[model samples]
Target chain A: MAASTLRYGRLRVVSAVAVIGFLLTSCGGSSDASDEVRVSAASSLSLAFAALGSAFEALNPGVDVVLNIGGSSLLREQILEGAPVDVYASASTDTMAPIVDGGLSDGNATVFVRGFLAIAVPAGNPAHVTGLDDFGNEELLIGLCDVVVPCGAYARQVMSRAGVEPAVDTNEPNVRSLLTKIEAGELDAGIVYMTDVRSASGGVEGIEIPDAVNVAADYPIAVIVEGPNTVGGRAFVDFVMSGVGQEILAGFGFVTP
Target chain B: MSRAQSSHGPSRPPIAFVVLAAIAVVFFLLPLIGLLARTPWSDLVSLLASEVVADALVLSAIASFAAVTISTVVGVPLAWVLARVDFRGRALVRGLVLLPLVLPPVVGGAALLFALGRRGVVGEPLYEATGLVLPFSIWGVVIAVTFVSMPFLVLTVEGALRNVDVRFEGAAASLGAGGWTVFRRVTLPMIGPSLAAGMVLTWARAIGEFGATVTFAGNLAGETQTLPLAVFVALETNRDTATALSLLMVAISLTVLVLLRDRWLRPQ
Candidate 1:
């Protein structure tokens, strides 16, 4: 048994070496010789940041801006794992707290924009969803973001305050996923950011949550102190907080800082 | 085979082989060790007893068992046709059957949504007529798990079916036995070990199925949220809860593999 185990162990080693060699070789020639600034942002900023990245590149000829977007908490986790991100922009300060404490950020994080929650449904409101109260109606197929994210946290708070424990079909990982499911008609309705509804435009209809129960999501951005390109990272952060950038965000229905 | 492997007789092992082997072991085992070292051992029991863990565990077991059963009933016939029947495009069909083995599970889930979701191509028509939707339901979880893990059962059973000698069936037919009798008494016994092995593998894969299930069925507690989905969500908020849930999965998977290793891998 010992001898057989040893043989299998050696076989595993052979395969492991093959995989490692393949990975190392696949890192082929770097695509950008120019200084590349990597920004890890929330999925909510996908459209907004794509515009910002292009404007930054057009201004700085020798530098390229790369945007990586996903759920805020997941992005923060990647940064904590030493991801080579120069700038970390999250939908909420809650997700950015750990990185700041770890001293990975250049300084205090900045709140750049705030997103409001909305009841997102298919165009024409086939589900006939009207107010936040419908979120508790078991007959409606509802989706919400998980509590780990800014949207999800706000979603839960709003639902609880409205005295409605929603019968959630799923807790999506990100705002974009919730929007996609809603657009696909897989979900009758989902609680997502107003900006997401604005981004999707014709694909979805946003029912504004009443001010009495509506939640405001604060977005935070910071430059990573240990990023590969600190100068480029700082530049990107400044550009995002710029008036021009704020206007671009406002066009997407984001409340500016 | 044992004698062949024991042949240290011809050449000495290379030094680089030993060095790389040690590195491989460390690379694979370090994360496991780290997880164990940082475990809130004192709180593990309480964490396991929580309502969320219980709900997820029950849901996972029910969905996985259903998936394995469905895979066995549906997959065995497909495996038989692929292995024993000679037809045009047989190789292409075989490759297609094994597609899920390599496809990313998340992509598989999205594809399922495109096909089975309410607004999906086929799903829209089906929903309009039958008022039945698959996503965000227990059935959706079962479908996603079955889609990804059934390939394991099919490929294994197909290999077993191909290897069994045909003469045994012919010899049995020469006697008074009918087709069903011959198959039940001969073909089945011949592939018993592989069948058992396939079911065990299928069960393990279904239980651990995550990405596809999350994507297709979603992450709703007591509905689509299985153990893996539960662990993932917990990982964001409560590390201790996530670790405890992960430990449950690791322990279950390890026990299954350890207890059935010989049955699955031993020579027939």
Candidate 2:
């Protein structure tokens, strides 16, 4: 009985394999140029860097910019795994420190832009949260970045400086998540980069944090020592530091470091 | 003369079987061995003592268990329907039920956001009606895990139900048993093993569900973070804790598999 029952199920295994094979074949074939700068960056830079990628392509027609945006910690792990990457622009120096320490770079690390952390609330601010002090209220659902990421570390720094123990309802892995929470009103407020507030386009509103309680976030860019496109990586780094790069970064609300 | 004949009749190839098994064992065990060999055992106790690991493990267990329970409650009946009832669009429903399995977990998380996020189509009214939010909460982790892992239980139970003979119910009914009593007395006991196996698979899937959990629930240490989330966070700063967490996950999964094999799959 068992043997007969199993025989009737054999078609399922075959069909599953066929479906997987079809998907693999469809996904495996792709056509793109080889000279593209495979730049892996932090997720927070998605909106700004997407615009920058197109602008860079226009500036250098022969080169394509392949952007892999993710959490800085995750990006660093992939780089450590020896992924085919050229330039790595992280949201914080802490994430870049280990790679640079391991001699994974050609010593081209530089801070290109600075960002200030601020409290972002929904457009209408229904919670009536007046300032940073309101974050201490247990009733207010406040989201924050996890301490593993740069944004979260900065938020921690800001909170510690104010001597305020903010009641964090959740610690998101990235700023975008925190932004989503505030915009969706799942959270009354979240601490994110000024640029994030700009990119949110007023679905959320920003409350400028007092300088005494704000932490500065810096972007560190470097060329991988084992990068296939070392020349292009260095060139891209220089391009981002030049006047045009500053303009682009500034357009995203990044203050010149 | 009969004992002598029985001894040689068995003729088991012990040497070849053991050698082949040894090679397979090493192939599978080497990576785990390497992780253990590299673990910083000196600081292992303190590392585990860290509040973050504790929080993450507790959260993960709660969410994963909740997910498995929810999946079993909802999925088992659906499996019975699929296996026993001939209905219109049944095949399409089966395919649609497995959609979460085929779609990448990240995509599942994105879909969850569209459905349950504060600004979501359904979530908006829910929030406005009761000031309740689903995303970024402990409940969100359960929802994400259940969405991705329920299909495993459904498929398993459906397969088992299909194999269960309807004659047992018929026999019970002919003996003057009512339908509900017949089903309870006849059908349920036969497929108990498969149901247990399905529960184990569902639990394992829920425990390992990372992409959807992180994307939808976000990684809040005591609130939304589970073991996989803990492993991820530990990977960020401490390599030793990451390995420990991973080994713990592997150990739990292996233990569950062994228990299922012993308790559910052994021939009666």
Candidate 3:
């Protein structure tokens, strides 16, 4: 009887341990200091932000920066969904305006750098696309960023300004996708940020638009109100708007806002 | 009364089955009902009529069908070998076959890129020999879809093959049936429902495939943009377009399930 009782006690202990293990595995996950800081930024700011992130990490002793690049709309959704993000930057005032209005962010957003939309052609200027008017060629395959993105909004601004109804073969999700098409020679021309052209590294050539059609892109950033690391978040945001940030942004060919 | 006896019985199989079925029905049907509920029916016809949406639908259907066909062709032979043949490292091969499913779809895409990109190992020779570039094209979509989806076909068909009687094959051989003939006439006929079910699963998986296709095929509209990719692109900027596209995907998937229900879920 004592042996049987011991056996039952042992079984209870085993089940208890298993339950604790299961709970620990499923719930109460690990938290430790790591180099990575998750930054959710708009897709249009990917090039500029990546360069800035690398430079920021270089100056900082141990902290590393990782950029989660996607549509500003999507990033907003993620932030709303309680993703573990430290910094949020967007491509447009319109996109950023909503985040600010929703009271989900702390501190007012500041525009650090500005970019203008330009027509990007394949390397060596294969299409010899001279100006925005060059996009009117029906034979040339033009890719545009979809209208929801800041880049797309800029492109539409330029097209409407020029009063040209150019044929668009594809509407990509981000500026990088448009750049990829231009680089592949699949698209004769695309509209992307001037900074993106610098990042492309000769994969595509940028054709500046006339002032009349050129629409400036503003980059806005804010800290999440409910972030676990508000200190790190605010520090990162300050570093981005600092002279160091300006240098990094300029190195990527961004004009000051 | 008969009802009282049934209810009071110790083993209430019918009642248990009813509860399980109710749970299953709610599990699958609720999400679809949610989609229908959220659908902007007022704008449905116009959204469907758009050329971009039409192109994506057609492309998705074609690519998914092609993916399922290729998976079926390759997976069946691989399944037969796995189930029937005794070979060295058979367990290793089985593990490798399941590698893609276990892998994150994005990683699988990157692996495909390394193997088949313009600067890839096989791609360099392939370009020189046949002037064929595997990445950034429609065929690349097929290859990506096939890579991630073949395991479903293989696992299902392999399970069916294992349960089939080997004595039938031995009898067919004694009756002067060649190996190929016996497989075609005897084995295939037995596993026909299994193959059908596997193909349906494969088709559904391919339709929903997004990561590998986007990475390998580069998401050029009318080229590599399947419905999922198109919906992703739409969701980036336009919430309405994304919702409309998602509703369409839900509708078609449900239609396929209903049409193929008996074949998909019938007991062997």
TM-scores of the models, in the order given: 0.87, 0.86, 0.74
Q: In candidate 1, how many Å is residue A178 off?
A: 1.4
Total backbone collisions for each predicted model = 0, 0, 0
Q: Pick the candidate with the highest DockQ.
A: 1
Ranking by DockQ: 1, 2, 3
Candidate 1 lDDT by residue in tens digits, B38-126: 78999989989988889899999998899889999988888888878899999998778766665677888888899999989988899
* Ten contiguous residues with the weakest lDDT in model 1 chain A: A2-11
- List native contact recovery per candidate, as a fraction of 1: 0.39, 0.35, 0.17
CA RMSD of all predictions: 4.7, 5.0, 8.7
Interface RMSDs of the predictions, in order, are 7.6, 4.3, 13.5
Question: Candidate 1, residues A1-257: lDDT per residue as tens digits?
Answer: 43343334333433443464346335445454439999999999999999999989999997888888998988887888798889999998889999999999998899999988889998878888988878888888899999888889989989998999898889987888788788877888888888889889688988988888988889999999988898999988889899988988898889986
Residue range with the least summed lDDT across 10 consecutive positions in model 2 chain B:
B1-10
> DockQ of every model listed?
0.37, 0.32, 0.15
- Candidate 1 lDDT: 0.84
lDDT of 2 by residue, A1-257 (tens): 74345324423432453365347335444344567787888878888788878888899889988898988988998899797788999999989988899889889479888888888999999899878888899888888888888898999898888887999878877788678667766688888998999889879999999987788888998999887787878788888888998899899999989
Tens digits of per-residue lDDT for model 3, A1-257: 32233333333433443353345335445354655677898876777788888888888878877788987777877787687787899888887886788787896888877888878888887667888777778766677887877788889889999988877756666776667657755567889888787778777888888887789888888988876666777888999889888888788788877
Candidate 1 residue B138 Cα shift, in angstroms, is 1.4
Please give, as one word, the docking class of candidate 3: incorrect
By lDDT, highest first, what's the ranking? 1, 2, 3
lDDT tens digits, residues B99-172, model 2? 88788887788788778877788988898899887876888988999998888788877887787778777889
Better of 1 and 3 by TM-score: 1
